[model samples]
Target chain A: MTVNATILSKPQVKNAGKLLAVLAAAALLFAAFLLANGADPLAIYSNMISSTLFTPYGIGEVLIKSTPLILIAVGTCISAKAGLVNVGGEGQFAIGALFSTAAGLSIGDSLPSFMGIVVMMLAGVFGGAIWSGVAGILKIRANMNETLTTLIMNYIAYQIVSYFVFNDLKDPDSFNWPQTAKIAHSLRLPRIAGKINLGILIALAAAVIVWLLVRKTKWGYSLRIVGGNANAALHAGINVEMVQIVAMLLSGALAGLAGAIEIAGVEERLRQTTGVNYGYLGFLAAWMAWNDPAVAVLTAAVIGFLSVSGNVLEISSGLPSSAISILMAIVLFAILWKGKGRKSE
Target chain B: MILESLLAGAVQSGTSVLLTVCGETVSERAGVINLGTEGCMAVGALFAYIVCAETGQPFLAIPVACIAGGLMGLLHAYFVISRKANQLATGLTLMFLGLGLTAFLGRNYVSVSTEGFTKLRIPFLADIPIIGDALFDQDPITYLSYLICAGMCLLLYKTRFGLILRATGEDENVVYAYGADPIRMRYLSVIMGGMLSALGGAQLSIAYTHTWIEGMTGSRGVIGVALVCIAAWNPAKAFIGAYIFGAAQALQMILQQQGLEISSFLLMMIPYVLVLIALFAASIKKNGKMPAELKKVFEAV
Candidate 1:
């Protein structure tokens, strides 16, 4: 048992050490940035760490913020595995929220909470799938670059949401505010702790399920084969286009599910600003984890901590909350620089 | 009257995208796509604003902005060429870095007023009818952009350097085998791309808006990237593509001014939607004009 433990622990330890080293380098670089800007890095770092991890409220906020990130990162992993880069998570999330909000408004208190939640989830999934489906089809049929197309679609989606919320779905009682009506209480996701709802659990379950699907399923094998080389997969009788399209749909569906949960589990209404930049932040998390679904969970949490502490940095150091973005980018750069030659693609 | 202004607006606003697309076209032609164009532009705008505010010289701000942008490109090149990082991911990181760093550093410059470029109207051309006014009467930078387009066209097609650059884009190994330093060529191209992108941002802040605002570049960098495809990786075609986008922006403004009852949000989406349609159209036609090595960066078709 001892001999077996050493074999398993060795690689895990080495990987952990590398991660720590990279993180230290990034932290040092970011500290210099802070110093250059006339802020004291040591005080800001301590304030951020203590306020974020040492307080229960802060921990809850971190978990809450990470719920959508975990969902989106796991979804990104699926598309990344299929050799598809789905940068449309922001658009997918918006469309998903739009769909689920419409459903929640109509089904309010008409069905049991359990049944209503399931329907919203499905609605979110369908919305997200359709959103990414266009980009996938364009890639397959039109030979359009998915990266640029999806990004373009993101702006269009935001406008679509704005058109709806500011007109058709505008809350009548809110004096022209661009937001949908709040859903019935029964439709909201039940909370497990202080303001921390079941969204985190759903996000976690989705991660585990995706990890299993990618590692253990036949479809996953085919997806990986296609990702490795489309021409080779085609020659080997794999339906490469169909596999990639499905992967794109699944990826978008997960992002949409995050939107649905944000509406049902947290926001309770759709707003124009709902889930803004969450997609890119989640994409960053996924990339940081090297597109591993399991690792995305931890990375999402780390990002969540940074985001929550952004407020603390602002309060303690007189720096803008956006300063945290610089640190996050530095961390990603360090990982990208140090993680060279690990994967050929 | 609206048509005249629309054409004139296209020339005015399109200059920024034109400069950026030209730069990106050259980079993509050299077998590297700098997604950090937006980041470079952001940094350029901020630095340009700072320089104009401090030194009171809009002209001096241009070179300062270019240097800042080139440094950003250098960082991207080091990661992509030396460390072999994923181009798209590194570019996005660079984007966030530029945006975040600018936002952090630009706190003081927000809403700060600065002296900017004065418009220059060509003497006789400005007196002509619609076409002359729309085409010839504008900022000095706008006139410079016309020259830039022509210069870039000549550099890409009429020069030996252009041949080597295009060859590098097609296949770096082939260029290497022919005894050319492909890596150095890529570095130069990417740096040039970054500098030009910053120049566009400088035009935007110093010549166009004449004030500092966070994220003022506003997806123009990404729009420039998208236009490269429609341009077929050619600098001349990029001018036409960029003006079309500019025309869309002008249309949005015109419609809004007319109080056309259409939601401004819908109109705001025109440029993006148009890009999507153009991309689809271009792809379906299968012009097959993309750089060979750049083709590997996108999904295999």
Candidate 2:
């Protein structure tokens, strides 16, 4: 290989050991947790893999789970590049679903399918931005902390949606379960047979949009400058506050879109079951990718795979769904912990 | 008598969570964010409940629970202090890890009824009207919370020890130039925080509920973090923050009990909404009231 190609490929080679180490440590954690919990670790793990990928149905499950993760992780990576921590992705996702579900049900076939989809997506983006922009403005105007504000916003978002879902949005047909009425397919994301659908296309288009914005745009350049050195960017005549605000708004919009797509394409309703909290799982994905959007695509997919398989482990071992959460935490901690080992030198 | 009972509920939530708030207060005073306090409390609650149930003794449960909480704090120290990971993220992961581990270990202890300790209502004080019912009638831990808050105040403001801890937090590099170890100081503070956090959990299981549930601490841990802002780092004022928040929660249940004209859920949302306000205020403060020592401890995001 040419020296440049080899160098370009070295990040992959360099990354593999870290990934392996994390995976191995994670495996060890699972083994210990399972052995203590009285489940056969190997059997559960192998079963998880088979159940997640062994069939055509399994592929759809993986894609279904992977979709939200991709969107949220991408948003996280984008914001992280600008040095803004949008831990509110989940809230933004929830708000998107919240705004659209109310609107989607009301407008379920009052318009053309394409027009309805467009409206839903716009509502999702608007909902997400409005949710996140509060934190952004707090950061810009009040010097408020975004992380905690967004976190508190998450609780508020939860309460808001719960109010609607439990009270107003309750599907009259579902016996009091806190979920919305399903929309007509005309409002649903178009399908691509076997449950795979056009949401993936939206995700891909988002990735491309983010990549182009970051690599080829002046705003991306300024964001990097600001992220690296806020004082320096301020000195360089960049409107730091405006950049931070706009960045957060876009960041929230994209995440909101993920919630909208996930609801319209996969879940079809806002259930209290947290068919939506993969945003917590997505935090690790963005971190593992070091907040680089392109790499987050892969990170999101990997997490998606682990969780999908984790479901299988749940079935065979009678373990809780939270077993996967524990595993994700282990992996995330290891990544940060191991990364720290490097910095310690 | 009915008012007396409701007052006890307010005191129970307030005083019990005070351990967590105090523990976090001590941590934040050192400029280390112990967002993991919730997870620590959960773990502490699990251990406290399990031990109390198994041993049928309250005193023994407290120690076991505190020790469990301290160990988790030590893990936090390992990452946040030793390795210098992002305090917010590290603290958050600590919460996630604590939640999972506590739930995993708490499998056998769920909904298992156990005898809990009795209240130590003060004599003449308990018989007095409104204020008396609110303050004087509570468990021994409730009184201890007052002592702990006062003790923390004394520790933070009175002695040379407090100065070192404060200086260690305010400008550790400066503290370091003066030949003190900021790391050692922060580690000590974190452990203190861990122990108190455990006691906080002990109060939850051994003092009030007397049983453990999965994720039972709910948002109390996060609220403890917010209480720091509410308390503005004053131990005594923290009690006000804690009691007021606890009362906010108690009011929700009380309004429901009285069949008041508000949505029960809306009442429940009150403290959380207040937390959002507290967070906004913390962010926008003219940057002075925030302990100067924290800047010395955690430099940037």
Candidate 3:
């Protein structure tokens, strides 16, 4: 008789248990924070929990936030698995959003409504892929540190976006501060089921695509083999450089898609702060999940929940928004510390 | 006349960026990527502004900021190296922590009336020529940066401790074979690097603006990271990398002042363009020097 492997996988069980305990400790810290502020800890907690799910808009907002996070993290896992650190996810994401916005604004009068949206989304993906591929190419050809190259590329992306938004793309007739013309609704990503947008659906589907690429396909197998052991994979004739470059390009494209989805689904135009920190959050999620693609979705949702809950607490308790960031740091440290429980040789 | 003024601004950028590069060079030498340099700089600027704003002792601001910055570094090292957390995550966290903490705490410290550090020159050198005045006639931080560069050269090459630290960066496990503790050496290296980075951050607030602003570190922190790559793990070369970036940044600011001529955004793209070329070069050199085993083998996420 075939038996379940529950008894055999002892270490995985223990790791899970240990992590659960650490998370419980963090929850206790959250309770303490509420008490220290002289507010009703239970009430705020209940309120945040209720607000997130009880209201339709709150649920929608969480999905909206989760959409981009999922896209970015999945892409992050791809590059990370290929043994490349693509910290330029932020830059790639921004460029995707920027190019998408540019496509929308420039072709505002030219294309049919449905076609414009498709065009914009494609532009974003290509823009992000190429942007990230530059670093990937450098790593392959020049032996550059992808980490440094990607990190530096972020500033270039930021500056160019800043220029486009503030100078060239500025809506001259608009009476408001520095911002672009609102992207036509025709170009926005449509919402599905009147709640979750097409973006979330796209992100979920993309994850499946990536999972297949990394697990089922021959190229995916080669990339993973190389990532697991570069020298060994190289000897086996899996062009390590080719795998890395392809993985990075794919990763960057996904990251860019995430940005485009954010624009299409939520904020229709790009802003300077057009969600930079989301990249960091995605980075965190990917890391916490140990680069596991499926787990990234859950981690992104958890981060979204914490942030949404933190916002509720901030408004009701008069605590600074930064307190949430502090809690995030605590939670992050707790997860990482917990990960170190009972190291193996 | 504007050209000379622009040239002078360029000099300022070189010196200021130098402060950060010198700090990063030391950290990378120990094989730790101190991504918190921007945050440390921001914290330093914030405290420098706050300390000076209080007690009317503007002069004490730099030292105070440096110490506070060192403490922040201590916190970073405690979490990342001590707890064995991922370096990139720790650095990013430090960045967010510094960004939020500085903004929240130093909101009130921004617009206070204060006299800042005045630019001083090496007396004889200041009189000699245009280049000399541009380079030598600057605030004390620039001079301090020069000393730091020289000091880095001596410490990394000449001293026994330097050799040990370098050896530690290459392979802590091997270094562990020796009597010295890798942990302690890392703590010391990271902390010192933090202090120096804070000084670099404080220099902008104290010497340049004479006041602190939230998010003042701008691209400087990221620039510091890029400098290590361009320098190819040599402190001396890192110094050169810093100046090149400084020139790019300074040129951008000058061009903006000159009416955004030549596309100031293009100017903004300067460091990035240089870095792209540098990365291409670095990637070509297959056996480029990366610390034997970066303190943390995996950046954890």
Top model by DockQ, which number?
1
Instruction: Please give me the total number of clashing residue pairs in predicted model 3.
Output: 4
- Tens digits of per-residue lDDT, candidate 1, A1-345, equal 998898568766786678789889999998998899798999989988988899888888999999999999999988888888888899999999999998999999999999999899889988988999999999998888888988888889999999989998888998888899999899999999998999999999999999999889999998888887888999999999999999999999999999999999999999999998888888878877878899899999998888888888889888787788788888889888876323433
> For model 3, how does the per-residue alpha-carbon lDDT over B83-192 read when each residue is reduced to its tens digit?
87778877877887787778767766767856667799788887755667767788887777778878888898899888888887888777788877888878888888
The top-ranked prediction according to TM-score is 1
Residue pair clashes in candidate 3: A142-B283, A142-B284, A143-B283, A144-B283
lDDT of 3 by residue, A1-345 (tens): 224575447886887788899988887786786677577877887888788868887787777788878888889889888888888888999999998888888887578877988888898899899889999987777767778788888888888888887888877766755667888877777777656679988888998888888879999888777767788998998889889999999889988888888777788888888877787788878777667778888888878777777788788777777777767766776786665555311
Give the C-alpha interface root-mean-square deviation per candidate: 2.5, 2.5, 2.6
lDDT at position B179, candidate 1: 90
Off by over 4 Å in 2: A1-15, A340-345, B1-8, B281-288, B291-301
What lDDT tens digits, residue by residue, belong to model 2 across residues A133-204?
Answer: 988998778876676677767777777777778777889998877788887778889989788889887887
> Model 2, residue B143: displacement in angstroms?
2.0
* Whole-structure CA lDDT of model 2: 0.78
Order of quality (TM-score): 1, 2, 3
Docking class of 2: medium
**Top-lDDT structure, candidate number:** 1
CAPRI class assigned to model 3:
acceptable
Q: Which residue segments of model 1 deviate by more than 4 Å?
A: A1-15, B299-301
The residue ranges of model 3 lying beyond 4 angstroms of the native Cα positions read A1-13, A24-46, A107-114, A193-195, A340-345, B1-7, B260-263, B282-288, B295-301
